[model samples]
Target: MTAPEDHDYDVIISGASVAGSAAAIMLARRGARVALLERRSDPAAHKVLCTHYLQPCSYPVLDELGLVPALEKAGAVRNEARWYTRWGWIEPKAAPSGPELPYAYNIRRSTLDPMIRSHASGTPGVDLLAGHAVTGVIREAGRTVGVHATGPDGPTELRARLVVGADGKDSPVARFAGIPAKSHENERFSYFAHFRNLPLRDGITHSWFLEPDVAYAMPNDDGVTVVAVIPDKKRLPAFREDLEGAYLDFVRALPDGPAIDAAERITKITGTVNYPLHSRRAGAPGVALIGDAALTSDPLWGVGVGWALQSAQWLAEAVAPALTGRGDVDRALTAYARRHRRGLAGHQHLAADYAKARPFNPFERLMFSAAARDAGMARHMHLFASRIIGPLRFLNPVALARASAVNLRHRGGPSPAPVHLPHPTP
Candidate 1:
């Protein structure tokens, strides 16, 4: 039955994944009623096509939600990220390591999603409608007011003052609200699996960029390493012909890899043969988008999880006044859109550029070469890689000067750091 013209919730968020759940918790904490609709009813159902590495940038948001303690208690590891370039590992020198959320969490999405959803469901003003599939958006005078969905029993119309699409890359809510995302050529396809007994740094996450091709061996909470490879589309034929062999060959070729080759895969080798990259403006009248619905960058960088939770928090802060009727909703939506662009547009542009599967640009050559030679430069760059700061700040004059000096110091010679992969932690 139709729930009439007025809204039953202050916000109706489609998709109860990371972005949706985070927003639900934030809004409910602010005294706004939220309806979190999830198509899958099972508490254990999870997003399988993900590496699920949350960058350090997401730590503050997790802390605000009081989730870090819980996640750590559940075996989440806090490790600094280290990258392998053609030269050597561009490892950051240790900063004054206090309890300042210095490391990132690598957990299975199957586990991470359920934990987040459980908290959102338990929040005071949140109504979690499990198994409710959003089918359409309800409109009045050309403004989005809510969503129409089918529950377990029958069709239902759920209205709200604001609608958020967090349903992923191909968001139905974004489509129904007529918010189009700008998509670009996707030059890569990826495959990954969780494996047992893979050698890992107890406190260091690893990424090896063999330029156009990238690989990862990350230690997750359950004592398994999530090994993944993103190869250019030109390699698709080989992957399709022999996914297992091709996948192993790619990972084996990483500068810091082949460790995953020895470990036994505990889960099926799962992945997307062709994953497209999409970027949306993410805000409109009475509606907004978060997570992949807002902007899906190349998975090679693994920014999705952090960005998902971060975007939700950003939107909640921007729209809190509007949801509570203290400020104009239209202005609030515009503010959210502006902040979204401010936060991600530069980062997304570079992500799209790299997704082209081309060799490093001159800027990258300077940056990587510099980062490899100089620890100070590498630490500053880490601010960018772990997403603590955006591109512009990372590329400031201080970093550029160090890179120039490093290039001159070697006079074009390659820079490879001292050997040190940590012994396994007890």
Candidate 2:
């Protein structure tokens, strides 16, 4: 097949979401030709369903990509995160006394996704093809060599040395490549939306831990707030009937009532039921997956967007040498997989542990109880909650001992019962 003129890209990325766009930006900036394909025709089209919360660690990559300024101009809000348990609110602690960390940003996916996509499309050596869907990967003797796609015109083919699957949770490229995905099912579903007029706590992303149920109220730019209700999957059917009302009720059940009361629902309530968090081994031969297509963690932690961007960065760094012919592609891909696994496997493992409907461990109990009583503890708890610290830090013998002593003293017993915090208002 003859390559399309002005369309012979070094890489063809399927799914023009955050990961794909970010990869395109990175590859194109390095002078590698890239073609980003999206099924949607509108360049301005956005993903409205995302929670839109990104961790502070992701800021470095955004800055490196020169996207922080653009994101700021796009009305993204910089905010610290707060964890609410039955014990109390764990607010961001002051530096020196606590873990020094950066604050995260809450931007509407509707705004952020498009901004990244637009910037990527404008980069030199990058071609953006909207309304195009990749049908299959073209392979030569077992190596991914190109892509066959259906575009605005009839059938079209584009050749590339590498093919990236950024098509999200159910990526067709991942399926076509025969990569197996292992998923852990949870007894929960998520209902989310954007609202205006909600009285939000300034500079803080709030999460309320209602046992077996979770709710979050994130304040974004432009007086907009995003709220989500994660209810047990059994209750999912009822939510399907009246998503908005169900979400509202779930929020109202929280200790401080629904946080979204001040804000009017500007968008319809959307719901996803029995959504399983899946993690797949990311690389095989000439193909690799990034973002949700690679690994999906529990949304309760708000790690999706940050992980997506971080994974894209990792993939680029891992493969750039190979793309430039300095290393073996297979070796580079293996190294990339190893790096990806090492970076997130711990976090995902912790998330999966918490995903189970089980009582909080001693450390969690202590941390929450202490955060309720001591401002110092609150800061530490915030750091861990922000994912600035690994689970091992919290579960260390010293920390665990402190938590046990605190719990015993507070509860007046050796074993303190798990405290059930009310869900926050959405």
Candidate 3:
């Protein structure tokens, strides 16, 4: 293998997906020399399986990066979420009592990935290198110094002070860096596809929690709709055998809804079997992980893209001081990891809990049940679901006590049995 002369960069980012591209754009704008490497030759290539929904809160970041107009011009659709539970459709609750922001947007990854990659490629101080597969990370004196990659010109070595692993779920850099990741397995699988000719209601994303089974329909630009079926893992083998039939059955089973009825299967049904969702604390030495590489939350909440961008933003903010010659790089990395864990710990914990096909907690049961019975309560639940309100805000003593009181009254006594739901097949 011929190794090129050691080239130095302020930052070397592996994986040119959303997080990596976002970081490259931000850093380049700040005058940092960046080398962005992608294993795929086509930078515009998109992940066909993702929902591609962007939360309203994520708009500010896209706006700050000057990407909102580009995305809008690309046919992005602004949407609000409509959740279907056994209770009812939860609407956005009014302020002074609900979340800070209540709406989001839906766009296809096919459109989003290319848009981001193009923007990053043109950003000043950012060198975009495609068709390069990273072989391993180069470490010196226990510090990450660079990366070893194979490109069209054969094996090449790129050195940098900071090496970032922005690769997705199964990141080679994170594994090579020996960052210990704590994982919780969920007994679930997801089948998703994009469809056209679907008569959608308004421009809202719809989610149906059909007891043990869950489904989501996100209407995107170009009259295309993304429908995902998340079922217990035990059902996966059967679904795999008849992917198309299984997907149709799963969607049809959801409580009769306009979006589902109007959706016409215009594309082949694709499924991911036994898709384990987990979160990992990604940081060590000269390397850090962002996006799915850092933490893969349950997609049921549709927070992957939002969290990916948010994590990249967090990493950029934390590393700015070190990158600009203010603090020790290693120390900065540690701080970034800590802040990441602190900010997402609670959220991930809750998400993981819900990922399991377990009986619903009193709070969840009460809130969802109330939402079904009352539009006002549904609005409150929507705020919490959209992440406008943190878990604590909704689970505070006052809220809990109020919900419990309602449960007690409904049961005619203080003691009530917990609601039991079938565990997702695994």
Candidate 4:
């Protein structure tokens, strides 16, 4: 669709990362003019502080965007996750559903960001404006009409019928639009680095739930493994003194942990000292937020990349009719907001609750224990962990009853062997 005489584009998206770029590509396919603005001038600029894990739920969207083939060609590793709990390891059988449902990818952001951005840049009707930083919103008649940004050339105003903020947590667009984020305090701090020669069977992600602390090792493309630890705030001082020592010791101390010492550290240890989970209104007036700008959940679940792609698809689908002058834009925005909330609110709440670094609640214990004992229960756990199902479905009556039965059958049996969790290795 052609832009209105007064508008430079039909839609202007801020931040050309996963969500922004994906939205641009999808919108352009529908024939809407899109301006994808990125503050970074370099086309290959990528995010470093990320888990880079895509969940199974995001598979369909990636396929729809025609990205899976390129991703696979770029050596993205397909992964299933193996979880370790006090009950035992919960490893479900490979998903029986055809090819795509069984696994997700763990591609480095250095590879992912540029690839999707390239797709957006190459697509017709998308103007990939690199080095453009949005400084403020352009409002007329109390509705957002565009953005004020400065690019490599100079300051300019880009007008559009719709403005999207895919700018990530602490979004300037959201802030400018007066959409305040309701944040949940995260009691854990995260640290991680890449290693080489750190192998895992079938390249499956391995995560350990250590009561108040958590650790995981994710295998990435080209033989790179990302090992991370999310420790409770109480241990912050020790880590502050010696980040590497504390990180290595923490991993080495996990029961049946990986052979970190044998692997070579390829990247400098880095992480966020404090990352508060945040959520905001999906949109207001002519503005819509996607990806981390819409909601920043706990990183422990590795939902960032998957959510980014899915939310972009959601936004494009929701507002495409309006972009084509077939429906009211405000109504479309409302629909998108409702859809996003219904889809992610429960997951976000649970993730935030767990981010408090607390011990397992009774429900979690029951489910984890049952998953350890029963293959069916393990599959349900996998489905939930992969974000393929919501918490309500995950805790349905049938599932709850099944878990109870599994635990009852194992009640008199000897408990799973106790694990000796040691302190940080010296």
> Which candidate number has the best lDDT?
4
lDDT agreement with native, every candidate: 0.83, 0.77, 0.75, 0.90
Greater-lDDT candidate between 3 and 4: 4
Stretches > 4 Å off in candidate 3: 1-7, 93-100, 259-263, 373-379, 405-426
Lowest summed lDDT across 10 adjacent residues in model 1 is found at 417-426
Give stretches of model 4 more than 4 Å off.
Answer: 1-3, 95-101, 414-426
Clashing pairs in 4: none
Evaluated at residue 352, the lDDT of candidate 1 is: 87
The reply for model 2, stretches above 4 Å from the true place, is 1-7, 96-100, 240-242, 405-426
Report the lDDT tens digits of candidate 3 across residue range 103-159.
556888888998898899999989999998889999888988899999999999989
Cα-based lDDT at residue 196, candidate 4: 96
What digit string (tens of lDDT, one per residue) describes model 1 on residues 1-426? 123235698889999989999999998898788999999999877888886889888888999999998899988867667788877778886656623435568888878999999999999999999999999998988888878899999999988888999999999999998888798887978899888878766445788776677778778887877888877777888778888877776776565574765788998888887777898877898899999999998888888999999999999998987787546766888999999999999899998899898878978889987888787788777778888899888888877887888889888554544222221122
lDDT of 2 by residue, 20-122 (tens): 9998888777657788999899878877667788887677778878998777877788867776676666676676754455766888887888889998888
Clashing pairs for predicted structure model 2, backbone only: 187-233, 196-263, 197-262, 197-263, 198-262, 198-263, 254-423, 258-425, 259-425
**Weakest ten-residue segment in model 4 by summed lDDT:** 417-426
Cα lDDT over the full model 3 = 0.75
* Cα lDDT tens digits for candidate 4, 1-426: 224767999999999999999999999998789999999999889989999899888998899899999999999988778888888888878556634335679999999999999999999999999999999999988899999999989999999889999999989999999999999999999999999998776667899998888989998888899999988888888888888889988988887788999999999999998999999999788999999999999998899989998899999999998887646787899999999999999999999999998988889988999998898899899899999999999999999999999999988877664343455533
TM-score winner: 4
Cα displacement (angstroms), candidate 1, residue 157, comes to 0.8
Q: With candidate 2 superimposed using the best TM-score fit, by how many Å does residue 214's alpha carbon deviate from the native?
A: 0.6
Query: What are the per-model C-alpha RMSD values against the true structure?
Result: 4.8, 3.5, 4.1, 2.0
Global lDDT of model 4:
0.90
Superposed Cα deviation of residue 358, candidate 2 (Å): 3.3
TM-score, every prediction: 0.93, 0.90, 0.89, 0.96
